[model samples]
Target: MSNLLPEEAEEKLVTVCRTAVGDSLRSLTYFNRFDYVQVYLREDLEQEADLNSFIGNEWHDFKMTQDAYRGSELGDYEYTIRVFENGYLVRITVEDFGVFVTTDGISMQDFEALAAATTEILDEWAIEE
Candidate 1:
């Protein structure tokens, strides 16, 4: 529902992610400060329909991530990857728009590709805005 992130870009992000991780993808959420889109979710996880609710709680936190390591010894914050027992969580924030993707076990290389593509897409849109 964000003017900065139309349905086409939302679908593009989902498509890029699926192409990167294929069937390992669990779900994807595209969000801005205003609202979020449940871009993709595998059928097996349909019963666990609380993902949006969970994401709602983290909007502020996700926004905070943008300034989190600003001007540190390391370069700017690109993305975040959290490993869990069963899968992984990837968060990429850009200006006011961002995406959070959940995926099953995937290689580090694939994760990097996904993050890079996701960041590039969001960054490009942010520039246009």
Candidate 2:
């Protein structure tokens, strides 16, 4: 139940991401087929703690989706958040919000931070039209 339409929400999300991850952001891709937003980071960046936080949000959503007993609060939400030595991969779907962020040189802590930041940004975005 977001106040904004799907397209508006998507645009706001892209703006928020760009504002929050300015210099480190390498590219932004929006997949119309799946309504996915992809944010790629620079290869030389280092923000493991931030990135880890971001992944944690995805994990939370994943767990919610896996819980059969829980009501459909997430609504067709599904995701994959993977981290490795060189980079990390994230694919998420929550209602009309689907985002994928792939980055290089991420650590456990960084991933979590990134997830956390994204969650915060989305929360703020959700409040607006």
Best by TM-score: 1
Kindly list the per-residue Cα lDDT of model 2 for residues 1-129, writing each as its tens digit: 223235665565556555645544443333323223334435665434454455456545655666763557566433455666655565544433445666545455555555556666554644652
TM-score per prediction, in order, is 0.84, 0.44
| Regions of model 2 farther than 4 Å from truth | 1-34, 37-80, 83-86
The per-prediction CA RMSD against the true structure, in angstroms, equals 2.5, 9.3
Number of the top lDDT candidate: 1
TM-score of 1: 0.84
Model 1 lDDT per residue over 1-129, tens place: 456456787689888999889999998988777777778888888646576675665566765665676777888877888888989989888777788899999999999999988888888888988
TM-score of 2: 0.44
- C-alpha lDDT of all candidate models, in order: 0.81, 0.50
Q: Candidate 1: global Cα-lDDT?
A: 0.81
| Regions of candidate 1 where Cα sits further than 4 Å from its true position | 1-5, 47-49
